[model samples]
Every structure is written in C-alpha cells, then in structure tokens.
Target: MSTVVEILTQIRPEFDFSQSSDFFEDGMLDSFDLVTLVSELDKAYGISIDGLQIVPENFQNVAAIEALLSRNGVVP
Candidate 1:
C-alpha cells in the first residue's frame, strides 16, 4: 500500500487514492472523509492536528497530507 494509504487504512477508499492528484477536487474524498482521515492521521502519527489545520488545502492530495503531518511534527 502507498504511504498515505497506510496512514489512513481506517477509512479505506474503494478507488486507488494514488491515482488522484486532488482527492477533494476529484470527489474521491469529502467532508466526512476528511473527518475520518483526520482521526486516522492523528492515531497513526501520534499527533493532534489543530482544528484550524483541518482544511481542504492540507488534504488536497497525498503530498499535502504528508506536509500536514510534517507540520504536526511527524518525522517525514
């Protein structure tokens, strides 16, 4: 599995996330997905993401999500 997928297995997507450049824009993810992803990310990275950091820009794609984890102090 891709790193991003590994980090978010709790909210498994039927489609391959790696194929999408922008999960939100592509309709691969939505508001409910974001909430589930955030919870999964927090658990996987052992960091609490700030409520303010939960934005579409931060979850636009795999790279963006990785960047968000880095911002939360999860070693890249």
Candidate 2:
C-alpha cells in the first residue's frame, strides 16, 4: 500500500497518512482533494473510480481505498 500512501502524501504533505484513518471526517481530504486523488489513482493503477464509489467511505483510509481499488478489479 506504499503506492496508495505515496498518492495521498503527494496530495497533502502536511498530514501523516500512516497515522490516520479518518481522511474525510477529519478534513484531511476535501472534495477537490478527492477529485485529484481519483485522477492520480486512475493513472497510477489503471483503474477508473467514479459514480457511487466516490463516496467518503471508500476514501476514508488506506485500507478502504485499497478495498475500493480491489472491488474495481485492481489486485491490490
């Protein structure tokens, strides 16, 4: 999940993603950040994340994000 952490870090370097799980609720990620993250994830993982999957739960944490990617056919 280093790649996922890398993407998150690239978006917001101030917060420590490794120590957090509430990216959305804690204000670590706003809608604009989510959009940028989605774009980066699509390019990095060759996966498309849209529609309902754009919800906060999917982007709440590293594990949740990984689960979303897996559900979208990405191995990890």
Candidate 3:
C-alpha cells in the first residue's frame, strides 16, 4: 500500500495523502483531480476506474479509495 502513497504523491505532491481523509468533501480532489487520480491509479494498480466506480463516496477518502482498489484486486 505504500506504493499507493508514492503514486498519489506523484500525482499531487502538495496534498498530504497520509492525514487526508476528506478528499472530496474538503475540496482536496476536484473533478480534474479525480481525472488525474484515476489515470494514475489505472496505471499504478493496473485497474481501470471506470465511470461506474467514480462516485463521491468511493473516492471520498484514502480508505475508501483503497477499498475500491482492493475490491478490484488492485490493492491488497
């Protein structure tokens, strides 16, 4: 999962992925952010985050995102 941090950092190094939980609510991840994140996640985890998984609740936080990734066998 640490690699996930690396990937996130590569996407948005300014954001603190560790303490960040309100990715959507807090405006940390906007529409453009989601697009970038999805792209990076697709490449890093080898799983495509299609429109079906692009929901507010799913990508709201790191845990939620990780859960979604894990469900698709992307993260462990």
What stretches of model 1 exceed 4 Å from their correct place? Answer: none
Model 2 / residue 30 / CA error / Å: 0.8
True-vs-predicted CA distance for residue 1, candidate 3, Å: 8.6
Q: How do the candidates rank by lDDT, highest first?
A: 2, 1, 3
Q: Following a full C-alpha superposition, what root-mean-square deviation does model 3 have from the true structure? A: 1.9
Compare the candidates by lDDT and give the number of the best one: 2
Residues 1-76, model 1: lDDT tens digits: 2367665444654767777788888887889989988887777667799999999999988889988888888764
Model 1 C-alpha lDDT versus the unseen true structure: 0.79
| Model 1 pairs in collision | none
- When sorted by TM-score, best at the front, the candidate numbers are 2, 1, 3
Q: Compared with the true structure, what per-residue lDDT tens digits does model 3 show for residues 1-76?
A: 3466677677778888778777777666778878887787887777877788887788777788889898888744
Scored by lDDT, model 3 comes in at: 0.76
lDDT of each: 0.79, 0.89, 0.76
- Point out the higher-scoring one by TM-score: 2 or 3: 2
